[model samples]
Target: MKCFEKLVRDFITSSLPASMNPLQFAYRHNRSTDDAIAHLLHTTLTHLDKGRDLSWSRHTNSLAKKARQCLYHLRRQRDFRLPSKVLQNFYTCTIESILTGNITAWFGNSTKQDRQALQRVVHSADQGQEDCEGPHPSQQ
Candidate 1:
């Protein structure tokens, strides 16, 4: 467990359903599109809450940058490894965090497809591949 993972876990779990048992997926390691979306949401929230004086635009942009960077690392590096569950945890939390960081805009809004689309672009660019039919491995 990395420090970033812990921070995300503490922050996201504090507000999410206790029964969600994010840790339970430890053995089922995978890094799918849905996982990424979930991570972005959670991370965006955590970053917004913890990142001092950061505006919504900056927070979202920063997350996007991080997501892109992770994609690049995952594809270009052989040892760029992380537990599937851990990465899934990170991705879901980050996604939720970024979206809801803006309390004013989080009131019953939706961006599932939009976020997935962004992830697709990042994944494709990093892998030099076309659209993935389903969830990705838990490597990136």
Candidate 2:
């Protein structure tokens, strides 16, 4: 078994690009005494756990930053007021696209905290739009 593991490691070292770091993840219920089985890489990989869970905080934070920038730019335009429909369209194209990008790939595997953070970003964007438009006729 050790010989096979060594061969596999040697093959990987020879085949993979130098820029890529080789990482080993042990997903065992019981801890193993063998250090080679779960050796840590020199540089830790970001946004991935041993259980293959993705940390989506970076992605969500990027989306929020982009959305905020778009909102600020839209609000700063003083030449003419953008119609509500146009504003909504812009938000959907710029912000919603970022939020939903690759969602199918990661959403199912995301932790509850990650999902809640994403939800907050969407909710805040919605609230910001309402605030920008002022009170609706029905509410007033």
Candidate 3:
């Protein structure tokens, strides 16, 4: 068995009630052989064979997914010729919230790749905003 799997098994066997079935527990795995991870409250915590470690890839990926979905809706509203103010409001209310939610907890610990991925989401939204600055279809 892998190191992480063994560690998880050991932890479960020790902490859980004997009467409770093991199948009820949910452990997050990326199929990695050396680490155990878990998802809690939109955050991901990881344990590695090297030592206790934190991995934010899962958390950042989920944030990117939610932000992209919000961006998609923002773009759709832009295509519909919604006013720039309304679009800005939508972004603030949706995408910004997704990107910033629990940011203080994970942003500092997140890897460079994960941080770059999130930046791309915001950059895409910025590009869309630049397009909005031009004469609107109705105005032109």
Per-residue CA lDDT of candidate 1, range 29-79, in tens?
363555656666767766776856433444445656665665554443323
Best candidate according to lDDT: 3
Q: What is the C-alpha RMSD of each candidate to the true structure, in Å?
A: 16.0, 12.8, 13.1
Could you tell me which 10 consecutive residues in candidate 1 have the lowest summed lDDT? 126-135
**Number of clashes recorded per candidate:** 30, 0, 0
RMSD of 2: 12.8
**Regarding lDDT, does 1 or 3 come out ahead?**
3
- Which stretches in model 3 have alpha-carbon errors above 4 Å? 1-52, 135-140
Query: Which numbered prediction scores highest in TM-score against the true structure?
Result: 3
lDDT tens readout by residue for model 3, 1-140: 69988998778658866565433444323332222222332333333413656578999999999899888899998888899899899999999999999686679779999999999999999778768778455667
Compute the lDDT of residue 95 as modeled in candidate 3: 93
Give the whole-model CA lDDT for all candidates, comma-separated. Answer: 0.50, 0.62, 0.77
Give me the displacement of residue 140 in model 3, in angstroms: 18
Candidate 2 steric clashes: 0
